[model samples]
Target chain A: MKQSAKLNTVNKWWQYETTASQKWFQFGLKDLYYNRGLILRFTRRDLLASYQQTVIGPFWIFLQPLLTALVYLIVFGRFAKMPTDGIPPILFYLAGSTIWSFFFDSLNGTMYTFISNTHIFNKVYFPRLVVPMSIILTQAVRLGIQLVLFALIYVFYYFIFHTASPSKILLLLPLLVLLTAGFAFGLGLLISIITAKYRDLDNILQFFLRLFMFATPVVYPASIIPDKYQALFWLNPLTPIIETFRAAFVENGKIPYYPLAIAGIEIFFLISLGLLLFKKRELDVMDSI
Target chain B: MRELVLKAENISKYYRLGLIGSSSLKQDLQNLFVKSRDGLTVEDPQHIWALKDVDFELHAGEVIGIVGRNGSGKSTLLKILSRIARPTTGSVRWKGKISSLLEIGTGFHAELTGRENIFLNGQILGLSNAEVKTRFDEIVAFSGIERFLDTPVKRYSSGMYVRLAFSVAAHLRSDILIIDEVLAVGDIEFQLKCIAKMKEISRLDGKAILFVSHDMQTIRNLCTTGIYLEKGRIKLIGDPPKAIAGYLNLDTQLSKHTYSSPHEAPGNSYIKIKRAELENSTIIHFEFWYTAEGNENLSIGIMLYNDLGQCVFDLASAPTRMENGLIKGACTLPENFLNEGQYVLSIAFIGDQSKLLFDFADCLNFNVQDNGKNLRWYGKRVGIVRPEFPIQLLNIDRDGAI
Candidate 1:
């Protein structure tokens, strides 16, 4: 309804006239902020969905990661003699696993948000970004639990092993997290779009993620790779993120420059591409789904 | 005489049919090749048109109902309007901060309490944080879930959950409201609340509303105008009653039949009457046949419920002429049956008693118009039989002259 002619001219559905071209972009940002509420709900759902039936709640969060770190320490670090760059294998492996698990959870979980939330999407209209963004927040809770575990181990390593310092790039830890989330959302969005047409991607994502865990340096240090594959290893943007996380936290406050910047750039590119594809798919995907 | 809020131009939507598998894809590709030589097969390569060339406008203070049978484009239009999905062709234009109450709990967390889900569900519908907080109390109170405010919704009963969700939606102050059949998911009282809330939104706020509902009474009460859709096309658009009548005509809910002879039906169809009588009976069962326009005269059957909860035996009429022709119809039951109760009739069409033909479930309901039998029923209708059962008793005096 037109309360005023000027307001009517600016933006109103009655006239079917969209406002200044620049306003649409601003709407997208505001839409994102508004959708943050659903993201919060989704995050809550994601974090607690697994533990809903359990007697002991989030304690499992700490126990699972701690137990996983222990298993890796015995199997790969002690039994196999895997490399840890002269650091205690437990501390080193926990550092890498802490970041890797968060990224993987977000990437793998978000890959199905579109499909999982289709029931809701078909029934209502909100920004689709709420789904992927929710996964990021949900996984953050899981990662937070793991971080507390990492702190306990860090304390043991510091007073016990006489090592461990807060990374100078700890100030940039927020940026690192953003980069990790951005890459996961970006790639997951791309995969979800393809999934509507070719559903095998769902199966591949589950299979390849486990396989990809072996490929990443979660247990063994990255140094085991020969010089020739160093370039190839960089292709997986996670290589440097996981490696940088390990080096900065465990290697005593040293920041790796080239690898961090490369990961950032790669994450930026993937997100941009993913958004483009996502926007295009939003136009008519309900029919396909 | 208020303000124009929205307009659409030649908007159309397309949908693909069939399952998600290899066979569907193979058919799609085959349809694609066939459509290449033609124009505008865009409505689905399987060659089904979900919506075609729809145009409409809405004033700010309007509550319009869209009614249609299944597969109509009512949902398709709502999807495009809400921006959940897009149209295949044409465009929709509007001016406002649009909000839809399509699905109330789109992303509700089972772990979250009612208080938490208020913000979550509000945001899912495009409401801002300040907007949600402003009306949070009203939402909780409206649902009458004050005690369970802190409890997780997963622990709440489905009715309670629907109440909470609907309450959140009802409290929203939005520019445009697009409500789907989601309200029907709630209980009757809750549905009444939802309809009342929408009425206020449309009348008081002057928010342009596009409502889709199967409940005719609700549609008549809430909507000022209506659009009747048939197979993806706008068949009629006018006053609510007229549009509804036209739509119902196409659907044909109430069926009626009368016959002189069973075998000598209107045509060569072999339709024989299994039973007949309008007398009150318990759970009245009437059977008929299935006949096509030009095929074998199939006998379809119907069962009607009358005053009283008593259920009579099954009456079946089958072995139709097996082609198109007039069908036989009848209703029968034992005598002195019905006691007293409200009732509605059910008619099922089946290949046999086991094989289903068509189930027009609960097609019609009528009042018994009680006769004066209890306490002399002074206030009720005074008659020998409830319906004045077309009978007479006469006394013959000794002398006609006297």
Candidate 2:
């Protein structure tokens, strides 16, 4: 019943040839593309599992950002009297916190890709990229819910005080989000490989993430920093992104083209380096992890 | 006419004993700076080969059962073939998609409901969301947990959890399926169902299957070909019966029964045991072939032992003169002589019916199975031998006129 033609045509064989060292550029993008369903499934699982036992399950997603922004509003706006570039303290802090949390949560989730998913990774073979991608998606979903809260407060502020003004640069919202996600995802990829080898890096990484919040001007505006440190501060890559986010949403401000360009290039380099390390390390990382 | 779906050539894997998964940045730093003699890294002595020079090809619609003892590299070989781990040497070339069920419920989340897990697990095994949706009803029915489909899987008993997991795996459409002792879990009825499903998939889809299990009955029944692995090397590759025989012979309690070359047989110069095997059917036939050169008063003796090392019986053939020629001695164990348990056969060549020339201890291992028709008291039949002796009455003593 079998045909000889089937045997003669041997183009589809997948050769698992174990070489001494694999090529660093072979990112297995084809495999990742094939496993898009798996990525979506993982994201759904993470979102559902995040708030399963909690009361008012999805409310926690918005509550987290609101509470953090409230704390920053009191500490920096009322106590320290930090300048807010003439934007409302609550709106300014909320916008910064919203964008910062998207980057923070995505990076936090993606950095632990190897440790958190050790059980599943040991048993099955999917693109290792799927984990970070899903982490980004899960955080993006939470950000979406938090943005709804931000919108409600912005509308209230606009109707009462006429302070919030939408800018043409607001059209770049999707691109800004992409840049934020890319920054977090790229840095998280590199950290994941590091943590996979040296588990001790986990504690050190947590401390650095907290320190990085202040470095990025999440609770305060960029105008407050002295002019001498301005050039040095813009090198943080996240500086221009946060500043551009605030410029587009709550203030009628000009976009910092030079810093934004610098941030974009930095993000591109980080992503390329992160992917190279990931592709190189993912094959044998299971043995160490 | 079967198509070759998987081929592994000279595959080998090595593991460093104490240092597995302990690689840290500190060690990497040390290795970076520290230099050994001659600028070559030192080979750690703890490195051990889990698999060495393993090679085989799997054809479509063929079920290959891999049998080995614990730590015998069976799982390691499966890991390499499944791409969970890479081989230290050699490579695997395969056509078509390969899906491995290394463990049931590999990615199942405890908090997720059964319905959610079905979709999650299906996609993890390479099914699209639409594909999973199409087979959702069939998967649930196959699992027989439709009543509890919405409950969190963590609340389900372990049995229910595995059933749901296996159901998802069973619906997977792959050209090659790799299974590793998943059927060893679950109850008997479910195990049988799993086996039947595997058979149906392999038959209808012409999928190449690689299975590993400790259960010999399942191997003999489900597998078309068996691979006997001993210490990471293929001991035998043939029909299931032959491979199973070779694997059974590897047991410490019962060792090899045949030494095809007389030079390597269990003997010095006088006599050698070339072959000693039992052929079981309605009658249990044992045959031993040997060669004796110096002794003319060679006699063949055999001792049978149960699994507990208890001697069941000892018998000797009449003394016979022999020269430098091949010799054969045979005996028949009547039906029902052996109980339902493992037995070992030890053959000895004797001189003048007194002096022992060569004694091959525990030469053959075999099992006598129950016919499964016992009306009651199905537990193990008492004793080493359960012989059915003939019984008759000369007369009924009707009116005492015998």
The fnat scores of all predictions, in order, read 0.50, 0.50
DockQ of 2: 0.32
Q: Per-residue CA lDDT of candidate 2, range B1-402, in tens?
A: 798888888888777676656677777777556544323235556667788888899999999999876567998888877767777778777877788888888889999999999999998877889999999999999999999999999999999999999999999888989999898888989999999999998888889899998777888889999998988888899998788767666345433367777677666666666666566533223333445545558777777766544578888888878665666666777776678887767678788887777777656777778754543657678777887776776866668863
lDDT of model 2 at residue B97?
76
Give the residue spans of candidate 1 off by over 4 A. Answer: A1-27, A44-53, A164-172, A249-256, B20-39, B42-45, B182-192, B250-402
Q: Where's the lowest-lDDT run of ten residues in candidate 2 chain A?
A: A1-10
On the 0 to 100 scale, the lDDT of residue B254 in model 2 is 37
Ten contiguous residues minimizing lDDT sum, candidate 1 chain A: A18-27
Off by over 4 Å in 2: A1-21, A249-251, B29-43, B250-340, B343-402
Worst 10 residues of 2 chain B by lDDT: B281-290
DockQ scores of all models, one per candidate: 0.37, 0.32
Measure candidate 1: CA RMSD. 9.0
